[model samples]
Target: MTRSPATPLPPPGERRRLREAGALTRDQLAERVGVRPATVRAWESGRSTPRGRSGEAYARLLAGLAGAEGGTGEDGARASAPEHSEHSGHSGHPGHHDRRDRQKAGAMAMAMAMVTVRPDRRGGGTAGPEPSAFVQTPPPSALPSDAPDAAADLTPAQAFDALYSFCAPALVRQAYLLTGRRDLARQSVERAFQLAWDRWPEVARDPDPAGWVRAAAYEWALSPWHRFLRRHRQPEPPPPDEDDRALLDVLLHLPPPYRRTLVLYDGVGLGLPETAAETEATTRAAAGRLLHARETVAARLPDLSDPRELHQRLAELASTGRLRSAAPPAVRGGSERRARFWTRAAIAFTVALIGATTLTLRTAPTRYEPPVPPGETVQGVPPPVAPGPLSEEERELRARLRAEFPGGPERLTPQAR
Candidate 1:
């Protein structure tokens, strides 16, 4: 059996007239049509057309309204009929479907473009571009508030998940190449994502969100401080393949800056300028580092002379290891947990400081106190005199008197004696 023809919709003007004639609000019609009120407005204004199930339902509703309005609906349709017929003549017409496709394509292109070619973010005497890729330029919707209306309907969490899903796995591998430590690589990606989640609105609005995350991850992986971490100090088991192991060892041996430049340019395929900007070095310095790194690698491994071979080998090395990133939800949860911990810590510290200040203010001396002066030695003070043998003439008499009194004292107390 032949398939039935799809339901037909009235002309845009007729669609609105029929709806008005039936006394239905845009909201009411949108609800019946299973779309947003904005969608209904778009339909009536001819900015967008309904399609598939929604379109068929919309057509059925219009047909019913046209039938109900009877003669008035008929006259209005006759008036707008030519335009609608012409508009629909080319199925999925440019003014109709092709227009939508172009719109969708345009939005995609814009998003992609936004992800690349960010302006230099470094501050200087002259104004220019930057990256984190490197800066953001927010509507408040959890993610980038100023993003296209296409993403307007999505919740912040959904948008975050989309970004996380797209960027996380690849980021893990890149982090591994930068640090030469699988666990550290995983940590770097997770921490970066955690940070991204914490500052989601800022990250979402960034010109190149993936690049922003990449920079964060790479920074963590290549940090000088990681050398101090207990887990990172010990060299982990090497790659299984001899070549892979040798390549990884060479990568690890390179100075962090050179390693990063090589990875960014050859492995991740970033431009020299981008690598330099990300590394916070001049373009020349970046070029020199990259050259030095390539030379070092070629010196160690003669077979991998070509840059292409090196790049391919690097990719293979990263792939050989089983590096994995945490789920987006877990990362988001961890980030929130960390944020809350720090928030509590800050609040506690603030409260404690305030209490100390208040206590000090209350108990502190209101006025300056004068301290007692210290005593100093006085000049020419008289010394104490000793009785010198009670004068020699008196000494004999005093001794005789004492001898008599000694015995007389006992005799004087006659009752006790």
Candidate 2:
């Protein structure tokens, strides 16, 4: 209990996403948020959290970005990148405002994540081909050509819709990959959104609102408890394509942590650190999981020995289903109802507990009173003495009495009168 509850914020990964979604250079964002660029870097890298006034400013900034990005949900997923790749240009070495995030993961991750070794048939490692293309993380759009220009100006409902429209579609696909069940995936996204709706202010102001919901959805989708549910005990139908089925099977074969890391990094295109943050893992741990996952997949389906192939296959597999999201109104309403019900239940429980305590207090003895001994049969009273051999004198007296009064002693009953 000594450990305080963790402050709710977008994990380090989300800080980077918010930065990218806004299409602002870290420096520009820092300038506006009133912090140094290095601090911003630190925030994004999971090195530190924003603290005090500066943190508030940063939160406000992120809130603005989240709001803005949520507005452009429809046209958002067209993640654009420069066509020709120079290692240096892709290095994302600072100095550009309007450029969409060069890489959601940053240059170092791009370098470290590019090529993973392939395991040969003998289980030894060899160099393998890299992923074909780096799929950028999708930014939930907050602006559109036809809609209002500023996201901050929008109403709460509108903002929630924007956030949902931006995240729900892709989130469903991602959830399907995690759960390997379309229904579960849909439920997970809906459930996550409902929770988000309940905590709308926190989520709306978060640096990466999408990432917040995403983490929740992933957690729910991958929960071990789901296996106990009758509906989820049996597996759902597989993807239609033969390749997709095999890929999904391979994915499902891995442990949940490894699978989540792979999907977040390879499938979702999160950078190494970002993936680690989102998965609540250390960078090294995330790397190990990712590496192991890739090895396992490659070993099982040699065609995907390259991480790139796995990434592409993951996207394809996730995209194959009809994992649609429920409407914003329904989700929001459900959230409100659930919140109210739980609140009432908690209040009732508290009232009942207090009443029981009050009754016990009232009836309980005020002073310490020793327990009374249990009643036992009285002792020391002699048992009825049967006739015993009479003493000489008593026997003589009895004889005399018997001689004097030949009749035995008479007993009389009371007359009715």
Candidate 3:
């Protein structure tokens, strides 16, 4: 019998993550490594895998950037999990099959974890009150409806699908909390996923693809376009639940980074280290943001004495029962949208600048008057009035002090005698 062809290996996700972690854009990295930008993009996208001399050089560059000894094992082997194929395994090699199976099992477990969305069982099927109708998408239950049973010997697309199906709902809910606008929040989440889909090769290899997407969604939800858009919108009544409405109101008042740090840490339950990674902040900086967020939240909700309880309550308030799991909408006319955004932003900025200039001109202190020549006064300006005669006691005291201290006269009389 003829042997089946081997499955193509998936691109290592670390290549992209490390490049990002190292703060090198694709073009920058390509320039540094003496390669075409397209080559680097290909390597990152897994369209063309790097190996041998090129792979080693690529790994070394990334490792150096990441401050690691090597991006691969000691022997310079790829660190990514080995790709296994059910149809291509040898029947005679039982030991090899067993090892491959074990690896597949571990990979599958990770894949499942990436997508699993377990609801709080303690609520006893009492799902939290529904959010505003526009905000409610679809909720993931014990298992996402689209999740594959196992990730055994899966392709990159399969892996990405599994991840997207599982995490999109939670991500949308998180975006909604950040933006407080249903349409904007949904758009943010969709845009994030769209980017992820386009870079699935890199995303597939990520340790926490969902976390990556969540961070992106946070940025998108908080974009400045929302501020400009708000000017044209009529305000709507707040959500019905007093606790939730109050929590959201407080969240909206927070600085964007502080709010993002809070959502990622307390609301999403991300560890400090991962939170820092996702936020592109130093661990110290991320901690400080989290601290400020908590203090602000506590100050706003004084009845909640315990910070942990406040965190819990905020997390609950952020939770939703539904999210849309469909594929992200296609991104079309991106340049046009960006142009419109910049145009609006510039107009608003110019208007504000003009208004500020007008106010400053109207409210500025009266024009700085030029000093008068010794014998001349300014036009339409009054001269200093002559002083009244000193009282008897003042003259006597000055004379006495001048007699007692000869230098005192010089100090007292600004003009020399």
Candidate 4:
């Protein structure tokens, strides 16, 4: 009889996890690994095993799934009961539980520190209440339906989804323009959303959530981490697909300010006023930036008929994952392992500039100096006034006054008097 073709086997990792969880049946494992049931039986019997990339990928997926289901012994698995209690203290001593709680609290504090939002540049125009006050306010158990205001009804999750859907794409596009790298764009956008999630209620209530997200993205893009990456690391360009190449060329060639302005106006669809508000510029200045941006793009890509087409193309590139192939500029290794060195450098630079400017202003001479008279003395004594060269009428009046009163001549005092 002719021999049947050999069957593929399940990934080692997956098979191991499944066995540990008591969930593995030969037939089921075989189906999962794309092999015949007999092949799975042979492998479980130690007669054969799967190998290579496909096996590895299958193993990783199975292990991840098993971990999610609380299985033990998988690489990604939750700890066994004893290990869990030892570390997490779900069933251990009270001190262990307290320590775990404190550890969790510290981790949360550190995460919050990573993406701290600076004070709004516009002062208190739209940032809502201070953080301390907001923290004290209790969150409602459930969001009220039929609430008249959109802001009042929005939950953190809903707000995040809204901003993600509305703002993330625009931010990603802007980041692409700035860095000419899709991964950086996506990361920048995601980081911005992560930040938005932290301040969801406040951001949700703001008049322009999109603008707020864009500003957050810009802040992240210009952050010290980003700057360091740009300076010390070089990002590899995306694969040379036609759409990818075209988009990259268009963005990379744009002057930095024009690229920023265009992305804010065209990609994000912010009006001049809103863009100006987010960028902390005047409306007229924003308009000028947009006008210049359009002109620049039009000049470079004259073959393109519509400005809207560029945005559409970017959207397409993003959706197809063409843009995500580029790697982020690496800043993972070096002196500041946990904190990015560039961020520290930027903070130092800003502080130094402020100090220098303050010192200069303090020491500089006043612009408006008082005028000094030619011969007048302003020291200790009062200045002498010279006698007037009188007109004929004034002399005649003086003579008449002297004749009218004998004391008039004495009244007309000497020049030095």
Best by lDDT: 1
Q: Where does candidate 2 have its weakest 10-residue lDDT segment?
A: 140-149
The stretch of ten residues in a row with the least summed lDDT in candidate 4 is 129-138
For candidate 2, the clash count comes to 8
TM-score of each: 0.59, 0.58, 0.45, 0.38
lDDT of each: 0.72, 0.70, 0.62, 0.52
In candidate 1, clashing pairs total 8
Clashing pairs in 2: 68-142, 69-141, 69-142, 71-142, 72-141, 72-142, 72-143, 131-308
The alpha-carbon deviation from the true structure for residue 368 of candidate 3, after best TM-score superposition, in angstroms, is 57
Better of 1 and 2 by lDDT: 1
- Per-residue lDDT for 84-146 in model 1, tens only? 565447433333444444443333434343444322234323332221112221112223212
- Model 3 Cα lDDT, one tens digit per residue, 355-397: 9999999998896978885786559878789989999999998
Q: Put down candidate 4 lDDT per residue, 293-392, tens digits, no spaces.
A: 6676667655344665555444434433434311111211221333456688889999999999999999988888877857965678867899879999
Ranking by lDDT: 1, 2, 3, 4
Candidate no. 2 TM-score: 0.58
Give the C-alpha miss distance for residue 8 in model 2, angstroms.
Answer: 58
